[model samples]
Each structure stands twice: as C-alpha cells, then as structure tokens.
Target: MSQFLSAIIPNEKYYEKSAFEQENQKVFQESWYYIGLTSSLAEKNDFITTDIGGKSVVIQNIKGVIKAFHNVCTHRFNKIKTERAGNGSLTCPYHGWSYNQDGIPFGIPLKKEFQGLDKESLQTLCLPEFKVDFCGKFVFVNVSNSEVSLEEFLGESAIKLKEISIMIGRKIEYHEIPNKANWKIVVENTLEGYHITNVHPTTFFKQGFTLKSEVDFEVQGQHTNMTLHLAESHKDDKKRAKFHKLLANRPFQPEGFFHQLVFPNLSIGSLFGITVYIGSIKSVSPDESVFAYELYETNLGEGELLSDAISEVVKFSSIEFTRTTLAEDKEICENVQKGMEQSNATKGVLNSSEIRIWEFQKSYMNLINK
Candidate 1:
C-alpha cells in the first residue's frame, strides 16, 4: 500500500463496541431520526410508512399539517397502513379503528362499548414528538431526551443550508438506495475529498470540481463542518476568479467548498449550482443500510431542463454510481465487521487526517452511552 493509504488512521472503537447497537432503542428509535421530506406528504391524508430506527412509523399530512405516528393498530397491534404512502386517515386492516394525521383516534369500530374510554388519551399516544425539529428543505429528529430544538441541533450549519435552499423552487425529490453495510461506512466516504481524486476519478477531476489541498474541520455538539478550497490557492487566478465570480451570489465558504456531517447519519455538502444531502436508513437490524440521498440545484429553466437535471443526477447517484461505489463500500464494511470480530485491539490511532472521524465516533458514543 502507498504511504498515504497506510497513514490513514481509522477509528474503529464504536464499531467494535456493541453498546451502541444493543441500546440503540434509546439512542435511535426513541430519539428523532429523519423520516421523509415534508413535501412528499403535502396533501391531507397523504402518508408514508417507513422503518425508523427499527420501528415502523407512518408519517402523514393531516388537514394542513404534517404528522407522524406509530404504524401499529391500537387494538391488535398490527400495521394500520401498509402502503409506503397514500392519502387517507390510517385505518386498521384488523379493526376499523382510524387515526387522524396527528395520530389521534378519530374513529373506533365500536364507539358505544368504549364509551367511558378517554379518547383524548390518544394524544398521549402521538406518533412521537422529536425534541428537535426542522431547517428549511430538510428536517432533523431527535429520538432521545434531546433538550434542543431544530435550530439548536444544527447550530450555525442550518443557516448555510437554508441559504442554499433559497435557490431551489417548489418541492425536491429524494433518491435512496439500499446497501449491505453499516451506516457509518457511507458517512466516512463523504466526509473528506481525499477519495475524490481516485475513487471517483471520473467525476472528480474530469467533471466539474477543481479541488484544493487539506480539509478544515469544525465540531458543534454532535455535528461537524468541513471546508476545502476547490479552486486551489497556488493555481492561476483566471479559473479560480471565474469560479468564485459565478458562485459569488451564494454564501461563500472559506475556499470554494463547504460540507457538513451532522452526527450519526447525515452528510450535507454544497456545490456551485447544487447541494448534495446524503444519509443512511438502516433496517430494524443494523446489518442492512439504505443510502437516503438527494441533490438540489437552482431551478433555472422550466419545462424539460429542470426535469432533465433532476433525472440525470438521480440516475447517476442512485442508479449508476450507487451500485459500483456503494457495493465496494459495503463489502469493505462487512469485511471490517469480520475483522473486528477476530481482533481484540483495545486502542486505535487517530492521525491529523482522521481526527474528525475520531471526534465523530466520540460524539456518537457519548450520545448513546449517556
């Protein structure tokens, strides 16, 4: 292996320890996790069923607002709505009991028999209120005793993202793919541009980016921000000047690059005309992971240009690159799991390059272990 590859220090402490995995009920399911875009369920009665931290949740648009509730039927404990998403109050297939968008029982099979039953108790049975809320086009959820709001959870990072959203019009579409790897694998792949020149050589140097040296890291609570000068400093001024002049309207980064990894499951990055939001959705079991992702750019033209752009990016990320890159990543993560089982190393090294990943692991451990 090359010296740089050998020198790449990786933090495997959290992977080796099962504390986070075993007690994820508190860290994951109970705490807020991102579900889906609010735009996806804009109409009243529109709902989608997805596994959140191993639990089944049905997020819906009721009346004029969005709400989420456990997919379980109150009486028989069966999934009330099985479709990924649709428009209607969730009615139990087992019993006729129905829940409104807020997760309150609007109707029951036998209204007479349960006469004295405090129907309002259903309020206590809300789908689950996340301690944290949302920022612009994206939403964040805290499933634990998150004593913070959406603004607090994101810190200053949310402002940057909201600024990016100003360029996008209407609703954005999400493209997600499943991978057989631990969710952490995906996050590590995104944090730094080190792999860009090689792993995605075609898309990196050949396509649009003119990346610069060294990454800048920032940490707030469990979230992190990383910056890079895409247009290198030593390089000639003409190209760099043109690059900056084009994107000058957007919030400027230290250099020409901006990226953030907001703890455990999200990686958000920005580009001249676009922003890439990547996150993972693991099954109830941690073995399988879903790469939930989307790319947004300013809606420049109407008609076919906008649709074409969305289609091309989605096809590239979710279909083409997803299979090749994600598969390689998944195989490595699985092998890492096997190696972790065999090795009994108590300590791991974190070099300058890996310090941020180390910090991320520490943040995850701190949240779950607490």
Candidate 2:
C-alpha cells in the first residue's frame, strides 16, 4: 500500500528519528545544491567559497567552466579557501597546497618532504569536485554525482528560468541570506499562497494583490512547484501603481509569469521583469538551517534614470518583499518548530491548500526513510 501520512506526521519534525524522518543523504546533501550566481563569477578564474551542510566549499570559473570543490586542505583537512570569493589560484594556508581553476594541484611549497610525488599525483591531490550546471546566471552544483540532469530535475521550472534569463540577459546580481529555521520551512513558505492572504496581508493587500488561502501543486521526481497566482484586488496593486509608469518607459510587460520550485526546496519565482531566486538550501537539523537568495533582472536602460528606477522600484520591491516575508516566515517556522517539539502525541493535518507542503514532506520522508 502507498504510505499515507496523517495528522501525526506534520506535527512531527521529519528529521526526528520518528515515523517521518528521511533516510536519503543522497536526497539532501550529495546532490545539486544551488551554489552561486553565474554573474558572481563572470570572468575566468573568478571564485567563491561558501558553506554547505556545514562544510566550506570553493567554486571557480575556469576558462568557460564552473567547478565546485570542498574547501578543506587535502593534507591537514583544514579549510582551503579563506575568502568568500575572489580571483586567484587557490592555496591552502594550512599546508601551502595550491590548485588552479581546473582543481589541478599546481604548487606545493615543500615538495622535498614528499619527494616521491609526481606532478600527476600532486595534480590529483586538489580538492574533490561536484557536478555543475546553470540556467541563466545561476549556478547549481550536485555534491554527489547524480544520474539525473539538472534540467530534468527542474521540470517546468527550467522553462520559466530560461524565460527570465532571456529577459534579464547576462546582467544581474546575487544576494544570499542564511536563516534560522529548517530549510524545509523556507521551502514551505515559498510553495504556497496561504501566508500571503494572512501573514502578508499588509504587504500584499497594501499593494492591492488579492491572495488566497488556497494553492496549486504539480510534482516531478523529488521536485515540485506550488504556484500562487495573485489577483486584481491585491493590496500591493495600488502601491504598485507606479509600476504602470514603466508603460511609458518600456513597450510591454515581459513575456512570462510563473513560479518554479525543485523539491527539497530550491525555488525561482518571476513576475513582470523581476525574477527572484531562493537558492539551494538545506536543513542542518530539525531546527537550524541556512539559505541563499538573489533578486535580479535585466538592466532597464543605460542612464541614471533607468538604473535608479530599476534599482529603486523593481529591485527594491522584489528584494524588500522577500526580505520581509522571509523574516516573517523565520519567526513562524521557529514557533512551528517549538510547537512540533512540544506535541509529539498528535500528527499535523494538511488541507488541500497545503498539498505542496504535504507533497514535499511525503517525498522527503520517502527518500530519507529508505
């Protein structure tokens, strides 16, 4: 029989060693984790060091390739790269073990100590690598080699991401934030519209966007997307009347409107010309988590007026809205975590509105439990 989780599950942390915990490290870690924005490392040799699943990692654009590696020194296992990002051949300060963009070990300061080592052997000693792929300027890395392609994993999201990327072209920026809730809660926040009509009533209703307590879900593999289609009476609409000013500045609204999510919680959402990314995020445990996000779109024009308008109006709206909502979500998730912690006897229930969250939990439970 197919597993059907009832009220007892949602009230419980899926990571807890209870009836709902996930068994797949291949599901969370060791898979494609959204790493960085391609714009962040546009030129060759441009690199970044970011933490994932508690381990530090480094990424670089070599020639035309983007590569990811554990930031630990192969010799002492010390974190190899110290800076968050920069341009250079990577060197481990711990033992002077150094590498190039290809993750090829290049220089070892004291080769005399290990005299028998050949160039190929030293070259092989660089940081280990994960698979990398991109949609637009965003970069994704699979920590463990996966048979599934990133495009296939994205499903319909790939289309939307491609559309947004076309509108924005190659010019954009990335801003990342780490939150204090389980990564799953962050995913839950993005997957539904229920919170918008309530918790975000001020933000949305004020802008004249009518939200619903309901949501819609579509699933593929472990990836699923829940879209919130805002309506005319939304509160954000009036405040966004200025958005109409773009009518004079630009010819028409950009071609697409859609929400994209690949399960275990990586999401990209788009409306008008703004495309928002809630990047690859993972839960450290039942309570703690971190996330990276970027708000970007194409530059509207060449001069000060266009740049100011793009940065101030569109960019500000997208970034500030996500910042506010995520803040609200973190608070709610912390409380949810606490509530779940105290209530071990009963399972939580999901109405149709929460189907996406349920879908996510079921898939996660399946992967982790097996």
Top model by lDDT, which number? 2
lDDT of 1 by residue, 1-370 (tens): 1222221223343353354354366456544466555665767778767666656777766787666666787666888888766777778878788776556677877767765657667665545433325576565555555565667666776766566545553334466666554566556656666556555555444433444565678777677777765445444567546744544444333453567776556666654443344444454344446676655544433311245645455435534443455455556656655564456664444456555666666666565566
Clashes of each: 10, 26
- The runs of at least 3 residues in candidate 2 whose Cα sits more than 4 Å from the true structure, single-residue gaps closed, are 1-24, 52-55, 169-178, 210-217, 232-242, 245-258, 298-307
**TM-score of candidate 2 against the unseen true structure:** 0.81
lDDT of each: 0.57, 0.62
Name the lDDT of candidate 1: 0.57
Q: After superposition, how far is residue 74 of candidate 1 from its true place, in Å?
A: 0.9
Stretches of candidate 1 exceeding 4 Å from the true structure:
1-23, 29-31, 110-132, 169-173, 205-212, 231-257, 281-286, 300-328
For model 2, give the 10-residue run with minimal summed lDDT. Answer: 248-257
Q: Model 2 has how many clashing residue pairs?
A: 26
Q: Lowest summed-lDDT stretch of 10 residues in model 1? A: 1-10
TM-score, one value per model: 0.75, 0.81
